[model samples]
Target: MAWWKLHKRDKPGSPTGAGGAVLASAAIITRDQVRSVVGKGQEWQAQAWDFYRTVSELKSGVRWAANGCSRARLYIGRVDPDGSSSPTPVDAQAEDLSPDLVARLLAPLEELAGGQLGQSEMLRRFSVHLDIPGESYLVGFDDPTSGDRRWLVCSPSEVTSAGGGGTIRVQLPESQSARVELSLDDCTLIRLWRPDDEYAYLPDSPLNGLQDPLRELRGLTSHVLATVDSRLAGAGMGVMSDDVVPASPQQTDGANPVHSDPVTAALIEAMAASLRDRDSASALVPLLLRVPGSVKDKFEWHSFATELDSNLLPLREAAIKRLAIGLDMPPEVLTGLADTNHWNAWIISDDSIKLHLEPKLGLIAEALTDRYFRPAWEALGVPDPEAWACWYDTSDLKQRPNRAPEAAEAHARGAISDAAYLRELGFSAEDMPDEDEQRRRLLIQLATTNPQLAPAALEALGVRLPNIGQGAATDAVRAPVEISRVAPAVEAPARNEPPALPIAASAVLDDGWRMACLDLAARRALARAGNWLLSRSGRSRRGELAHVPVHEVHMHLSPDQADLAQMLDGAYRDFHAATPGETDLHAAVDLYVRRLLLTGIAHERGLLAGHLAAAGCDRAAA
Candidate 1:
């Protein structure tokens, strides 16, 4: 019989030897038969019920894996004719297809998976495709002018493959009686089965390998719950057994026999009622029964107690560990074990992403590239539609161990630029300071150290310099004048009147002031020589110092000697040019004495020529 004719009558209680029975008996079933059995018929309904129940039961681990795997970032890319692939530009366009430009283009496909379906829900549904045969979604575009050209992603339960498996028919959600037929070219189908010849149509799942562990986990959990319930059932209830003997009959007067007295019986009944009320009100409290002294010895009391074995803890842990092993995740991640340190946690996370998530993400990327992106591109009249593809950015999915120290060392060793170092530390261009800003900061540092370059640096950076006159005015306003005003002015003493000095100068008198002039010149020459030596030695290594020429030292000192002479001449002129009222005699004498002391020290230490000669010895040896 024809496949279509078989599907029309394929019901649970259909006539034997008819179309339905013939199709069921056949070993090789067509797509129409598979769909009729697994899509909309009683079998489909039963499978759907089982599918949902399994999902609900495995909600914790299943959701964890699905959400974690799908949280990866998605992006579009294109393959070059030379076989290289690069991410497509965010603003890329191709005729009427601007996939990146229109945010809503795939919104329905990602979020509107019929009714309240969204990207996460869609991912979860796709993740379960392995549990079922496959996943199917009906695709439809919204109005282009409305800027809502999103494809509708309907549930797979509503879709059924046609006879040849090349097309599908969707039973509308609004009215299950109405059906819309579409070719496979217009739908997005993700099969979890192998594409090879063998087992091509059979569904496969990672969870299949975890069945034994999952069963053990369920059994252990049920045992624990049952144990707890049993303990609770008997908690605080006093012993009640028929093994105890009854109390011996008590002797009493005829009028006061225990069973015959109404007042005594009434009092006993009231006390029993009160005890029952108290026991019921507080279940934790144990009820006590009192007997006559004579009868107490004849009766025995017992206690009912329940204690759960502590060995069950290890069993529970073992079950959980088995589950984690099956899932290929860290035991701590699923069981909340807190013994792991940061380093171990990081290693586990990295391993989980590499082993579990990467393969799944690769499959998803391939599916999106082949089934969705390629078709969309082709519809837009794009040239070489096979060149374009979609991918996920899994770079941020795993936690990278701290590498700041290594990157800093590399930067210090000049192995990487500042930008490259930043990138290694997971920073983008936007996170780093711009070249202009860095340059401005460098200029500011240079100006701070040199002072001479302050104006030029400030001008280059468009920074206005403070006016010199304004600074002078502010300083003058803050100057101290109260001390000078409070003290009386003292006139200079006579020069020959035995000048009162802080330190007595050498009493050696000269017929001319030639000695004083020579002393001043000597001090100035020593100062000039020290400054010249320091400047000439600029960054010279100890080994290189021996290679310097003696002539260079002599040449270096000549210009400094000339400068010293000019400074000495200027000082002499300033001293001689000063008016008597402007200069104090004691101040002039003190300055001459200090210069004399500096000259004596220089002559005694032989710093006048010996210092330069010693430095030039290295050069002389060379």
Candidate 2:
């Protein structure tokens, strides 16, 4: 038999430490049998029964006993209630390890084996889980009976498997060491034992929230980081010491210095630098999307596209995965390589005989559209057909002297549209509308009318027209179209009414000064006309006149000099009087011819008339 007793150090009235057998006296007995002295079924008596019942299930009594009861010893340390002396520790005589105790200990385990309850099921009913902090980690558990339901907090890293059922190791809250193992063979048993409270921690569990869909990008980030580390290592510091540079120091010194291989920091800086050309930087997106490991943190593609001008190229898994899993960009947007026309021109238009153009890789979708796709349209081959008429207005194709004449003819022949041509120059048709088309047409018309316009006009159109005179052509191709002889002017039917004083011819003329007002009026008008052609479609302006209206067409006059009309007028009479046979047409004659042409142009511009009487012809006659 077991006994309970207090040691000599225990306080008065405390039972002897080994008097465990008698410790289960009236105080320990159930109140149901104590109604004679105590009151009938009270709340306190009910609570006592519940506690005893719970304890009884966890223990088993031993029947065979050999000796008399041995008292249990207890030790109680003195306590200083006012902190006058010291605090005391308390200990009590422990009860016997009876059969009821054994039964209680195995109660959950037996229930688990019998398919009554599960071993380790998630407790999802409570607001908060209780975590006992240890040296390095925290262990969490469900609080039973405190709230409406129970909860069990487990490790997120732990994997729960249902084999021959599962196993849950229940731990005691007071001691970090306490535990009880239970095996549940039936799924129903585990389900029934599940708690109702919700238990969650920071960074929410996968079930609590969707895990980062871009987690796979972490691999790419790691690769990039590794590459960056190697690059940085290779770029040696000014001073070489014995030990390695501290990583923290490297991180703190944020600006990345350029080195042999591009580090991630340098690459990122490069990307940022590209953003300065906001338009072109968009091209980097496709390339960047392929960079693994948290690439999402590096750039926001949509915002970047909207903010910067660039091109993009989809290279590997990183970019493709994000396309499928995260972003909603369209397929055309993603693969928007430059149009065929521009690409072909860029690659073949050059005179290198073997063209080499290499674009950066891993660009984003938007950047790809802007940088690679748009510019590539011309070289890639024109996409549309109707834009050729005004192609010179918005593109720079016709000025390529090195380009094959066939290509220039192709442009002039409406084989390619302005939009297609610009697309070849890496421009997008999405934003450019029909209004732009009309504007482009007007500008081209203006440029074509100006004979004095620079070759840059054709360059803007993407094709340079080679100046091939009849002498340059093969003899077999000297074929000429029959021209009608100068016929007398035919009279037109007179209008019944005179035309209204047509909104002042000045309205059609770009220059405001009239011929009567200034001697330079004609020259000024000519210059104004040249200026008008040059300004039209080279760049864009949004306000004021949306388009220009024309009243009369004044074709440009060709001459080597700027004031060709004045030069030509000065040489006209002399050149006309020179006797065709008598004059020795030597090198000086060629020079005189050039001067005559120049003077005629200047005369037309109201400058000076040509004095073409072959040099000393007039003086010789005198």
Q: How many residue pairs clash in each candidate?
A: 0, 174
The digit string of per-residue lDDT tens for model 2 on 143-216 reads 34342212232321121222232443444345667553333221111111111135211112111111132232
Question: Mind giving the per-residue lDDT tens digits that candidate 1 earns over 1-622?
Answer: 3221221222356442122222111122224344543354234334433533543334555556666665666655555557554556333544556555344333323433342334545555555443332333424433234634334434446666665655666565457586666543433333323122344333335454555656665666666555443322333223333443333334456864555454344334333443456345333333333444444345444444334345667876776667666553445566775777876777777777777766666666665555445445544445665655566666666746776766776787799888878877989878887888889888876565333466798888788876676443332123321112122122222323433321112222221253344344444444444444544443443234445442123223333322332232223333334333322332332233223222222231122122222222111222
Error of 2 at 57 (Å): 73
Q: TM-score each candidate.
A: 0.48, 0.15
Off by over 4 Å in 1: 1-58, 78-121, 128-198, 230-237, 240-310, 328-332, 335-339, 399-442, 449-452, 459-622
All models, RMSD in angstroms: 18.5, 38.4
Candidate lDDT (C-alpha), each: 0.45, 0.27
Q: Compute the lDDT of residue 327 as modeled in candidate 1.
A: 56
